[model samples]
Target: MKLLKIIIVLIGLITIISCKNEPKSLSDFKSNFYEIQHNGLRLGDSLNVYFFENEDLVKSVEIIWNGKLLKNHTIMDSTNTSLGINNLKIKVNLENNSISGETNVPILNSFKETLVEFEVVKEYPHPQELFTQGFFFHNNKIFESAGQYKKSKLVTYNLGSTNYLQEKKLDDRSFAEGAALLNGKIYQLTYRERDIFVYDEKTFELIETLKLPSILKEVWGITTNGKELIVADGTQNIYFFDEKFNLQRKIQIAGYASIYNQLNEMEFIQNKIYANVWQTNYVLIINPVSGAVEQYYDLASLSQTKGSDDVLNGIAAYGNNILVTGKNWNKIYELSVK
Candidate 1:
C-alpha cells in the first residue's frame, strides 16, 4: 500500500508540472503612453494585440482606462506612468485569445493640484518667419509641416538658415499639418487633402498618398506611439492604426464630461501625450486610458506676442526640453524643461 501511494504521488506531481504554462510577457502592457485624448481605448473599452514570442505568434492584450492601466494593459512610451504598488494582479494564458487583464486606475484628483508651471523661458529665434504648424526634431534634423488651409508646405527648416534645407510644395491647394518618419519614410497629413501623403525621407520626394477613411472627418496632427501610429482630427477624436496603417482603434478628447475642443498638433513624451487645445495658450498633458486631463501646462506666457500663431500649435521634444511653434510663425523656439 505504501508503494502504491508513492506511485500515485509521483503521477500527481507529473500532472501538475505538465499543466504549468509559459511565462507571460506583460511588460508591454503596463501603462498609458499617450495622453488620454479622444480616440484611444478607455474605460469600458479594450484593445486586442497579436505579437510573436519564442518564435510563435502569441496573442496578448492590454485593457486601458483613463489613458493608463492600473492593472495590466501597458503604455510603452518612455513616459512615467506607474502604479507604485504591488497590489495589482493580471491573468494570462498561452492558448486562449480571450483571456485578458483589466483594471481602472483611480483618477487621482490631485492632478487638478499638480500644478506644472511653464515660463516659456525662450521662444524659437524667429517666431514669425513662416506659418509653421507642425515641428519635429528627428535624428538631429528639424522637419516642419506648414499649414495655410490653401497654401501648405512640408519644409525641412535649416537650423541656422532662412532657406528650407529641403522642401515640398503641396499644389497650394492641400493644407499640410503634422508628419512623422517611420521606417525611413515620412508620412504627412493634410488639413483637407482627404488623404495622407508619404515621402522618401532622404529625397523629400512624394512617394504615395493614402485616402482617408470616408468616415474620417478630419486630419490634424499625428505621431507614432512605438507600437501603433496615432492621428488627430479637427474634432476631439484620435485614430490608432497598426504597423500596416490599418485602422485599429480610436478615442475622443472631452472635458467637464463633454467633448471640449479640437485636439491639435501632438507630441508624445514619456507615455503621455501633450497636445495644444486649438487656439489656446495651454498645452494639455493627458492620460490616455481614462480620458482624464492629468495635468495642464499654461503656455500663454511662452511667447512675446501671443503675437505670432493663432494661439499655440507646434510641439516637439528634444531630450528634456520641448520646442513649440505655431501655424504661420517663422521662428520655432526651443523650450526649457520645467
Candidate 2:
C-alpha cells in the first residue's frame, strides 16, 4: 500500500510539472513578435518580413506560406503568386514556448491594360424615367433592374419596344442595384438594403430573399457564370458567392497602376468579367481568375444626355455584341468591340 501511495504521489508531481511547462497557444501572446511590413501587397512587389529584437525569447524562426515552409524567402513577385488571397504563417520557437502569427498576402495585377476600340452598332428605345442599374438579355428579351428608393423595380421588355412585358416593383425601402438570371431564377441586388431578392424567372414571383454578409459595405453589381454568383461593392474588391449568398472567395480588382474602385453593374461573358466603373465612361474587361484588367473601352460619346447623374452604368451580352446604357438615359446603345 505504501509503494502504491508513493507511485501516486510521484505521478501527481510529474503531472503538475508537465502542466506548468507546457507552452501556450499563439492567441495567448500579448504582443506581436514579427510583422510582414505591408499586410496588403501587390503582385511583383518586393516583400519584407521584420522580426522584433527578441533573440532571447526566440530560438528559431520558420516562415510557412500556404502550408509549406519557405527557404531563403525574399520577394513575393508574380512568379510565386497566383493572384488572390494567400495564407502566410510565421512560427517562432522559444526555449519553453512556440507560437505562430498568421496574415494574408493579397496579390494585385502587375501588368497594364490594353485600350480596346468599340463602335455603336444600333440604338434602342429605353424608358427615360428608368434609373438603369442592371441590364442584360435573356431569350431574345431585354431584362432590366432600375434603382431608387420607392421606385426600384425589375422589368422585362422587347428589344425595340418601350413597353414592359413583365414588371415587379420592390418594397418601398429596397433600392435595387443589379440583377442576373441563373438556374430559372432572377437574383436582384440592393444597394444599401444588403438583401438579395430571388424570383422565379418565368412567373416573376418572389421565391425568397437572402441577406448579404455584414462584411460587405453595400451590394452593387452582380452576375453569374451559370454556377456561382459574383458581386461587386463599389470598391476595389469583387466577391464570389454560392447560391445561398455564402461567400466562397474574394479578389481585389487591379488595373495597371492601382486598385480599381467603384466597380458596378458587372456582366460575365466568355469566361471574362466586364465591369462598369461607376461615375465614369470606362468599362473594364477583367480576367475573373486573375482579377486582372486586360482591356478597357471608353464610351463617353454614346450618351447624348449631359446630366452629371446620367453616367454610363449598364452592360449586357447582346449575341456577339454588348448593349450599354446609362442611368435615366433614353437610349440603349449596342456596341461591337474588337
Q: Which candidate wins on lDDT? A: 2
Worst 10 residues of 1 by lDDT: 80-89
Worst 10 residues of 2 by lDDT: 28-37
lDDT of 2 by residue, 1-338 (tens): 99999999999999788657554554434334234424446676665544434445557778777677765345676456656556778787877667778876656667779988888899989887889888889998989999999999999999899899999999899999999988999999998887889999988999999998887989889999988999999878899998898889877787766678899998998889999998888999998877889999888788555776778888999888999898998898889986
Candidate 1 — which residues are off by over 4 angstroms? 1-113, 119-123, 127-129, 255-258, 304-309
User: lDDT per model, in order?
Assistant: 0.62, 0.82
User: Candidate 1: RMSD over Cα atoms?
Assistant: 14.4
Query: Each model's number of backbone clashes?
Result: 40, 0
Residue 236 of model 1 has an lDDT of 61
Tell me, what's the RMSD of every candidate? 14.4, 7.3
- The residue ranges of model 2 lying beyond 4 angstroms of the native Cα positions read 1-107, 304-308
